[model samples]
Target: MASRVTMIAHLFGAMATILMLVWLLHYRGGIDLDSDSNSDRIFNVHPFLMFFGFIFIAGEAIMGYRTVAAERKVQKLFHMVMHLIAITLGIIGIYAVFKYHDEIGLSDMYSLHSWIGLGTFCLFGLQWLFGFFSFWLPKSSLATRETMKPWHIFGGRALLYMAICSALTGLMEKATIMGLKRGNESRLINFTGLFILLFGLAVDLSLSLAY
Candidate 1:
């Protein structure tokens, strides 16, 4: 059951990435970090990286243990590596948005999307740190680790959903800002959001089944 669900999650992840790329490149005009329209180009990086790099990879990290047949330590290592990569990309995504804002001389963290995004990112970072220190390097006592396990799992799952919320609101906010009507672009954006939501749901389901 877990394996089947994991496969479904992978399919959703792939579909989400394809839809995001099509929307960004075909509908929104391809991204460029050093373009004349710095604000728009840089803003493009925000969604691409957040969805493809951060959320997708984070989902995989969460499923690493259940999906992979490996030693416990190996699974843990893969999980941490995936999350670290996601965090690195997430940092770049956040930077891209702030850079875009700077270029446009606009204040930051003024929207609901921004508020939830920033909160999720900070909490994710703290969760990653706690997981690393508590479970990996200089490992805690077995009793201590066991005590912290449930909170760690709950926190991770909560943050994953928080990220999906951020992505959905961000998509709507961008669509509104761009005045997207009932067209291919708008429809693509809607589908992308749907796939992202599905991807999150599938990952959570897989984890629950494994447990």
Candidate 2:
């Protein structure tokens, strides 16, 4: 059952990523580190990275234990590694948006979406640090590990949910700012959002059912 749900989550995640790429490359212009000529191109990286890089990676990290047949230590290592990758990609995504805002002369971190997104990212980093110290190198004592286990799991789940919330809000904000009312672009945006939501839900359900 968990495997089936994980497959579905993978399918949805793939669809969301494809739709996102099509929207950015075909409509919004391809992503770049810093497209001075077109800041919109720079902005495209924000959503793609946040959805695929951060949220999707974190989702896989959350579900990997249920799906992989690895030893306990291996699974734990993989989980931590995935989260690290997610953080790297997440920070890059955040940077893209901040750079975009600067290029356009817009004030940074003003909107509700930015507030939630930045807050989530910061908390995510802190969570990773806590996890690393508690479970990874210079590990805590066995009793301490057992004591912190539940809180660790809860924090991981909570941060993933917050990331999803940020992604949804960011998507809507971009859609509204672009005034994509009734066009292929608008439809694509809506569909991407739908798949993203479905992917997150599937990930959450798969995790719950796994245990």
Candidate 3:
């Protein structure tokens, strides 16, 4: 059952990735890192990186225990490494948004989506730092690590959901503010949001069953 659900999760995740990429690259004219000259192009980078870069990667990290058939040490290492990648990409994604705002002469953080995104990102960084210092840097005593494990897992799960919140809200903000075309375009965005939500739920469920 666990494996079956995990497979389902993987399927949904891949579909979400494909949909997001198609929307961004095909519909949104692809992502641009070098040129802030095109505000629209830079804006496209924001969603792709935030969802696939941060949230999707973080979801993978959360499922490492269940998905990776490896020793405990290997699983832990893989989890941490995946999260580090997520954080790095998350930083770039956030920067892309600020850059987009600047390029368009738009005042930043004036929306609920931005507010939630910033807050979730700050908390995510703190969570990662705590995990690093406690589990790795100057490794805590066995008892201490055992005591912290549950909290660490809980925090990771909560933060992932918070990230999903940020993504969903950002999607709404984008769709409404941009006044995306009434028919197919809006439907595509809505389906993307649905898949993202499903991906997050499957990750959470996988973690719960595994750990």
| Top-scoring candidate (lDDT) | 1
Q: In order, what is each prediction's RMSD in angstroms?
A: 1.1, 1.2, 1.4
Instruction: Tell me the lDDT of candidate 1.
Output: 0.92
Which pairs, if any, clash in model 1? none
TM-score of each: 0.96, 0.95, 0.95
lDDT (10s digit) by residue, model 3, range 48-85: 99998999888888787556899878988888899999
CA shift at 53, candidate 2, in angstroms? 1.0
What TM-score quantifies how close candidate 3 is to the native fold? 0.95
Q: Candidate 2 has what TM-score?
A: 0.95
Off by over 4 Å in 1: none
Question: Which digits, one per residue and each the tens of the lDDT, describe model 2 over residues 75-144?
Answer: 9888999989999998999999888888889999889999999999999999999989998976579999
Instruction: Give the clashing residue pairs of candidate 2, or none.
Output: none
Instruction: Provide backbone clash counts, one per model.
Output: 0, 0, 0
Q: What tens digits encode model 1's per-residue C-alpha lDDT throughout 62-119?
A: 9996666898989999999999999999999999999889898989999999999999
Candidate with best TM-score? 1
RMSD of 1: 1.1
